[model samples]
Target: MHIRRRRAVGRHDASDYGLRGAEDGAGADHPDLADRRHQADHPPGVAQVAPWLKAYFTPAEHHSPEMKEALRLSDELVAKLIANDHVVIATPIYNYHLPAVLRAWIDHIVRKGLTLGFDGKGLLHGKTSTVLMASGGIYTDGSPIRDRDIATQYLRLILKVMGINDVTIIAAGGAKGVDLSRVTREAFLERLDSEIELAGA
Candidate 1:
């Protein structure tokens, strides 16, 4: 099986938290580590499928050139997702939530004709997904700000709307300080490691 890696940030994001594109960098130190580590340990069992990465994140709007392009991009992304057996989203949290770029990207791909039907029934099925989120602050189940995590929650709910019920979320945060950074990164890796094993099983 192949694991698709979905990155939600861009180059300019580097200035902030050094950008999570770097697996070991400060910004989301373990960004997408789940997919990367899983693919490494699992050999060819997993591969990152992302044709829409080139589409990147586009501006949010329903009736504009960007939206039109987003629709096309989303259509392709949906196709890829439909074709894949497994998928994983590697993302970093921004302001107690996922970056706006990811939201915009989702807006394009979760199309009615593609992932859902006119009767509001989900058409996309027969696939499982996991979400790995790296954040600057802790937001676990009992965290004081758990309710503020719009990104992860939205991801779970939205993916459900697409008929993907076997969804799992691995949220790793509390990287705000030098002390918390290493600890947080380790925890993130550990969680991903466990999840990878489970997926392999």
Candidate 2:
């Protein structure tokens, strides 16, 4: 099983961490599971989906040279999503939602003819997904601010639309403590070690 690890921020490559097969419970030691990382880099003007949409809607015969160029990255991203059995989206929440780059990545992958059908059916099936989200505040069950967990809900809905029903979300809430130096990063992560291991397995 091949898994695509998408890090919303390009600062780090997820492949370096060997976090493959987390969705299917195939532990990292699974011999057949391989990790393929795709960093969603924040290149200048790369997150604009309008140009790609314009090119995609234009008739192929009447497409300009620039149209093809506009579709290049979107096509590549969609193709990669289709090729993988499992997809891991590691992102940080921004203002109670997804970062611009991650949202752009979703826009690029949710293609009409490829990932989504014209009839509103999802083309990509039999796939699983894992969402690793770090948030500044706690919003899990029992939290008063749980209703503010828009990012998780949005991702689940989108993935379901793309025919990926089996999804696991590992929420690392209260991450601000790390930034504030109230809790060590290692200690915070250690608290979630079992959850992370189970998700990976």
- Which 10 successive residues of model 1 have the least lDDT summed? 38-47
Q: For residues 104-148, what per-residue lDDT tens digits would candidate 1 score against the true structure? A: 546555666567775787776776776667677777888888788
**Models, CA RMSD each:** 10.3, 5.9
Q: lDDT per model, in order?
A: 0.54, 0.67
lDDT of 2 by residue, 1-201 (tens): 223243211111222122222343543444433233334343223445577668888877788889988988777767767877777776678789987666766777787888888898888788877777778899999999999999999999998888889988888788888778898867866776776667556
| Segments in model 1 whose C-alpha atoms lie over 4 Å from true places | 1-71, 178-192
Measured by TM-score, the strongest candidate is 2
| Clash numbers, per candidate | 3, 1
lDDT of 2 at 200: 56
| TM-score between model 1 and native | 0.61
Q: CA shift at 5, candidate 1, in angstroms?
A: 12
Clashing pairs in 2: 25-201
